[model samples]
Target: MTNFDPAALPAAAFEPISELGPLSRERIKTRLDARGYNYAIDSDGDIGGRWDDHIFYFLLLGKDSEYLQVRGRWSRTLPASSLGQLLVLANEWNAGRIWPKAYVRTEENETLGVYCEHSVDYEPGLTDAQLDQHLGCAISTSLAFFSSLDEQFPEAVAAAKEEIARLTAEQQ
Candidate 1:
């Protein structure tokens, strides 16, 4: 059996919703608005955007777990947008389906504000037999998704890696 040390892992960093920038935030808001979603932005830096029937919250962390929530229930299922796609890709990476290689890039045309790409890799302690059964289930689900969406999965994974790389480069 492999000895696992969760403590050796690095702490997860919280990415501020504001880091997406006003323009990006506005774009998301506008999209939801056009879809007839009810949302509001307050002085406290909280943004709640909703469409269909789902609501998601984006909050700014403070003394309280400040966050902004955007929620909506979809009348019909919808394809995941760029952001949604990235999120799924990130989840897959975290689950060990894909390597955690990603970078961010900004286009000169300004049409695409920021983009990312990610590679695939096998994660240790993630697939151990002794690991939680739920974890195995989650990873299996992710793998099944990638298997079913063969073509799209590679593209999405690549984009995730690119986005991560771009973000890292920008910091330097």
Candidate 2:
């Protein structure tokens, strides 16, 4: 392997970043606002936004709140009958992808919910650039998986899509 010197690298090879700090909701909001994306604050003080008929939440977890979890839920909840099929799909997705760990969960009413999550720990902290990379990876990868689900579950999602559309309009 060729030995590479970090200091010898061109400055242009790197992007400037702000001082590292613990990831916070404010930082998340800053990035979202910068993109001019519409978002909402839940009654629980969680931050979330919708894209392509799906909802995603930017959450800080861990004992010290040092982990960032960007999570998304599919637009539709599958009937109980689909649980077995969904489990297979989730397993296949996890086996094939590196980002966005896909999984299925049973809701209280026995329906199945498909979720995609990309979580990373930053115990030391993170810079603005690193945070942006996390956000981008979380969103793009999750969307890729969601798009596959859309194709696979068109009949299931069609009704949910209409409901979400109606709710979105009502909010407006």
Candidate 3:
């Protein structure tokens, strides 16, 4: 066995956002809005936005936990038959990528939806720079993963569009 040295590891510092008060869900929304990205606060108080064909959302876990939940949804839903394939793809992504792990879930209409989620928790708190970096990383990773899904299965996207049109016409 090799000898371990605790001093070899660099110490991390927790820098709180002095200019801002307690980081709440509302504060997260305000900061995001100030950055000029268009977003909507849903009935559940989660903030969501659409960018480059991907729908992304963020939910503040809680002030005590200081955790931010970020998720990205593919605009299209795949057929039920594609669940196995989707699982395979998600597993490949989870194995290769560290942030924004992929998952598949069934929607109310029985369509399979692919999603990616990442959570960041600040021990003491977060600095403004840290918040900004986290936000940027979350959004970009979501958009990139969505694009990767599209590139991997173009047919699923096209089928989803057709299904959307059919559903819309039925509603009308």
Name the top lDDT candidate: 2
lDDT by residue (1-172, candidate 3, tens digit) is: 8788766666643333365445566667767876888888899878888887678888777648478878888898777888998899889888988888789999977888888888877656666666777788888887787888889889877886788799999999
Score residue 42 of candidate 3 by CA lDDT.
90
| lDDT by residue (tens digit), candidate 2, 1-172 | 9798888988977654557787889998998888787899999888998888789999989998899999999878888999888888889999988889999998978988899999999898898888888888888888888888888899877888688789899999
Q: Which of the two candidates, 2 or 3, achieves a greater lDDT against the reference?
A: 2
What's the C-alpha lDDT at position 10 in model 3? 60
By summed lDDT, the worst window of 10 consecutive residues in model 2 runs over 12-21
Q: Give the candidate order by descending TM-score.
A: 2, 3, 1
What C-alpha lDDT, on a 0 to 100 scale, does residue 30 get in candidate 1?
A: 53
Runs of candidate 2 exceeding 4 Å displacement:
1-18, 164-172
Clashes of 1: 47
lDDT for model 2, please.
0.87
Full-model lDDT for every candidate:
0.38, 0.87, 0.79
* Per-candidate count of clashing residue pairs (backbone under 3 Å): 47, 0, 0
Model 3 scores what on Cα lDDT? 0.79
Model 1's alpha-carbon lDDT is 0.38
Quote the lDDT for 106 in model 2: 89
**lDDT score at residue 101, model 3, on the 0-100 scale:** 78
How well does candidate 1 score on lDDT at residue 39? 69
lDDT of 1 by residue, 6-74 (tens): 776666533332222222344445554554647688776556643222233433332333222222111
Can you give the TM-score per candidate against the true fold? 0.23, 0.83, 0.79
